[model samples]
Target chain A: MRVDYRPRRVSSAIAVLAAAGSVAALATVSEQYLAVGISLAGVLVLAFGAAVYRRGLRVLGVPIALVGVAVGFAGFGVGVSLVGVYDRSFTYTGELIGLLGLPFIALGVLPVHRRLSRRLVSLGFAFLVLGVVFTGAVNGTGPDPIPLLLGIVAAIVAWDAGEQAINLGDQLGSDARTWPAELSHSGGTAVFGGLSVGTGLVMFNADITGLPLESLLLLLGAALVLMVALYK
Target chain B: MSNATADTTTKARATNTDAATDADAATDAEVETATSSSYGQRVSTDADGDDLVVEGERRRTGRWRGIVAVALFASAVGVLANTPFLLLATVPVAAYAAYPRLTGSPSATLAVERVIDDDTPDRGDDVEVTVRITNTGRWPLTDVRFVDGVPPMLAVREGSPRHATFLWPGTTTEFSYTVGAEYGRHQFDPVTALLRDVSGGTELEAEVDCDPATVLTCTDAVPEVPLRKQTRHSTGRLVTDDGGAGIEFHRTREYQKGDPMSRIDWKRYAKTGQLTTVEFREERAATIVLLVDARPSAYRASAEGEPHGLAYNLAGAEQLLTALGETRDYVGLAAIGREFCWLAAGVGLEHELTARELLATHPVLSTVPPDEDPTDPDEQAAELRKRLSGDAQVVLLSPLGDEYITSLALSLEASGHPVTVVSPDVTSDATVGSRLAGVDRENRISSLRQAEIPVVDWTVDEPLGTTIVNSTEVMD
Candidate 1:
């Protein structure tokens, strides 16, 4: 009767795909197909580990996660290629794939340690966002903006859905039928992501290239005030 | 409002501030008084007679704090890097941060009722429990998570006690689970409900007291109890040392003038030309007292979600009492726990009924472990020794968790009473401390055996009756 909090199938799918999307964005900017292949493979292997862990088989799950992490580290070693297109070219973007290994390992352990896995998942998402920014800003060639924005949005949605799944597992055990709540939560996150992209598109169309620094500062201050008002 | 609080407090019969205050805001005092008057004060006023609602503490889980921090970080990075794509990501993050705040806190206006399929089930039968919850409030509960309080003594065999769903205003939701019934009566506790807003923010927690206080009573008579050779002068099942007229064989003696012809050993007489009479072992009743260990230390369970040691000990006592009742032997019950309990040994249908009833419902033998060790163990033992008759044999049902129980068994054996120890093994190897405890329990069991007490080592995995039968056979 161990209550397992391993992310369900839907949440696990979102997290893996968003993580891959992050790596793919890096690959799209740098033309590194090898890194994308290696990262996606790591994601697939981690999925297997999550499945094995859910079946209460820790003996097999641990080794599978260890192998997946080893593969991911190999990718990390290969992804750190210097291009020096922007002010800083020290791209640790390879860690976007490597960092997820910890969470994948946490996902398979019995009585899934909620706090530790949560921290690891957030840490992996942070690495993904940091890598996306670095890969977009420092590409020797002109970086594509569409994939970069999609990658960032995907990262946030992935974290949201994964966290929701963990909580669902905690509150209602694995034996419970919890798809309705999980699906609705994930759907909400996906819709929110779409709205964000639309907002970004609208701001892009407004031609902010000619705006002055003083106006940008004033806009930021107004936005801060609005946030404070809404918070209350 | 004060009137409502006072009424709710009286009905609940518990010193809970949350139930009192929460009832005051939503329910009127006059309506509450009318409901209490009609229902006789046990049922809550918010819903039907079955449901009792008490508000619980509220706290933020802070699940989305990382998203907020990510949004701030992305916005700072985007403004410096002049990247609008990164800046766009901050919009969704900020929305996530605001979503929970915009959603109103869910109210604790829910009516819950639990229905047990069979109130009196046979041992090992699966008893189904269905719970129905209705949203009695004006607003819908977007995310309602609840766990039914399945009795600890019963193991859930089918489905889950936990559920998460949404219920609109005046709508109902249902979930059911089945538990395998064991011996004795098991009472269900309150249902714990956690209500979260649509955005999974602002949780309202409460305990719903569902009536009519479902209790599952499972009883099965044990066919035989292996008692020691000690016996009373009364005719009963136990074979005694004194030779008389019985089915089993004993030694032969020289024939007397009044000896019956059927009892004469004709073959022996022909071999030695001697008149001899055959003597058979006598059958007599045994006065047996069942002592249960209900001390707090005996409440340990081997694993999570399993019944504790005292639960198994009591169950064993029930089986023994039922088996011993069918025979001519006199059976009595006693407990060493928070409160002292004793029923004098007697033999009859009425006495059997009273002993069984007390064994099932006595406060000292309650399924819930006591809060503290109020009585001195030595003093309780002395009291028990004073109450027991000189010819009575003691059958001690314990877990042998500590050395004190082993000493109790030894002292009883030393006091001229034939003692038999029925120990339920509840120690596990889940941790270093638990493993060490298991070893310690093993040492105590071996020491009791060394003192010549017949120890029935009952493992939880096997049936208690089978274990008892097998162990007693080995002892013979």
Candidate 2:
């Protein structure tokens, strides 16, 4: 009945490895899309692990979300860096990653407390929406673009650092071995299972992702309940 | 031994050591100890009635880590079915189930000990009682209450039971209460204690026999006015004629002035030289008898403020025994209501001491010996009827409510046994406003008056001196 508030253990080594894997997954998947979205499942697993394990969430959430946004942005940051052979489409620096999308993933699910994480994530989401609105207003690029882009980079870095700090916090406990596992699992879910799924669905449905968000989310939720009821 | 308040420290240590050992030895099987049975199973009967007891249930698991299981499931589902936030709603629901946070094991002993500071009490006298509850188990006691069974013969109201919030293994909690007492030797059969477990869903019961101890001591109603003259052959300050040594004259005789200075009769010498000074002697009572009662009805229950006649009568018996015992007089005892209860009369403090001890130690209901001489009653009546062989004084100890005793008192008077009725007050009905008690009182007093037996009605409130001073027979 009494909450054991004592600091718990953390696995620093596992956390670093999880963060590296999440970023690497997003980078490789961005360049090499497999159409079926099986890589999306990997992202989801990492996200779910982060959310469930206290330390895992803190370690993996920011890195995975930031990496996904970074991958999306890398395609946009360079002009004509990628020209699809299928349609000879022009890939612009801001268009592919969508200057604002990465910010949402980086900032949304990384805070220690749920409310703060939600607020920060929502604000980032709002910025992304603004980017779309601004892009439509200016017909593509804003007046002061570098600072805005740097601001995007700064936001992602801040979120990643915050996630690392929370997951590796002395406050959660000095238990080195337990913390990394807790942070990686919990942080990974808050992002991949939590935010990444939102981004992936939103992108898929909103032409931003070229897929359906609600239907995809519904299928995932239903599948979840069935899997647990059957397997667990 | 470690002086820990509730044996918690000892239990903690034992739990650390014993549980580890047990866990290693019986890793697969759960062991149930001797203290596992609940209190309801400990009930047993005694002379008074069935002793009361206390009892409860318990159950333990590794389900605490299951809280995180939701996330892993949520993730797999999110990828397969495409939903991500489904688990957010199930967050708070994951904290259910009963889990033991207890660190150690408790000892297997639950003991109940009751100590009556004083078992014998005078009516309206305060007596202290203590009940100690000990938990020998290593577990912490959540809630516990102890109840003491008081005999109905004693006028006791339900007092607050003591609570031992925590009784660790090898630890005890002693609870005490101050209770007012009435006369008579009341018995304490068994002590009952109920204890609860950490979860409070289970309980424990324990009952232990505690030897009876006196709580309220009702001494004889002490007489206020000191008697100036001691009874003949009775031990006291009174001077008597049949004595071994005396400063007073028993006879007068003619004597010469030349006799020893101490023996010379100065008045006789001045008048006629015939030294005829009277010789003085000390007086003493020949025999003294104390009559007590042990009839089944004599031990009937009475009111709270006013006890039954038996308690008062016993109190009076105590006083008379003390007074007579002090004078070094031959004292005899008789229980009027029951079978032959008279003890052979003897002299000195030892005799009265024996009688006092007999009354003090006697229970309300004493079984009549089957071996009594078949003719002792009639023979005793005949013996009482014989003249008091020269100034034997008799102290009749009674509630003065029995009719048969009054007739016996008259016969004793006729037999020349000078009798003093020393009654202990059983006067709840003296005012008549009390209807039920009044009828019983009226019948009792009438029987004494018609028989011409001197009666002393003792009231609990008034001192014994008032009864003696108000007696018309004693003044005469």
Global lDDT scores for all candidate models: 0.70, 0.42
Model 2 chain A lowest lDDT segment of ten: A1-10
lDDT accuracy of residue B348 in candidate 1: 84
For residue B97, model 1's alpha carbon misses the true position, in angstroms, by 4.5
| lDDT (10s digit) by residue, model 1, range B1-476 | 23432343254322112233344534444334434442212333444432367788876766765666666676666667765555555666677777777666887887777778888898788888988888888897777888887777788888888877777888888889888988765667677898877667677789886544556777754557878788888899888889888889998999999999999999988899999999999999999999999888888999877889988887788778777877999888788888667888888876666665555446677676787655887888998899889899999999888888888888888888888888899998899999999999888878887888889898877777888878877887
| TM-score of decoy 2 | 0.39
Docking class of 1: acceptable
Over B348-405, each residue of candidate 2 has an lDDT whose tens digit, in order, gives 6545545554554343223222233233345555544452344555667665454555
Error of 1 at A174 (Å): 2.6
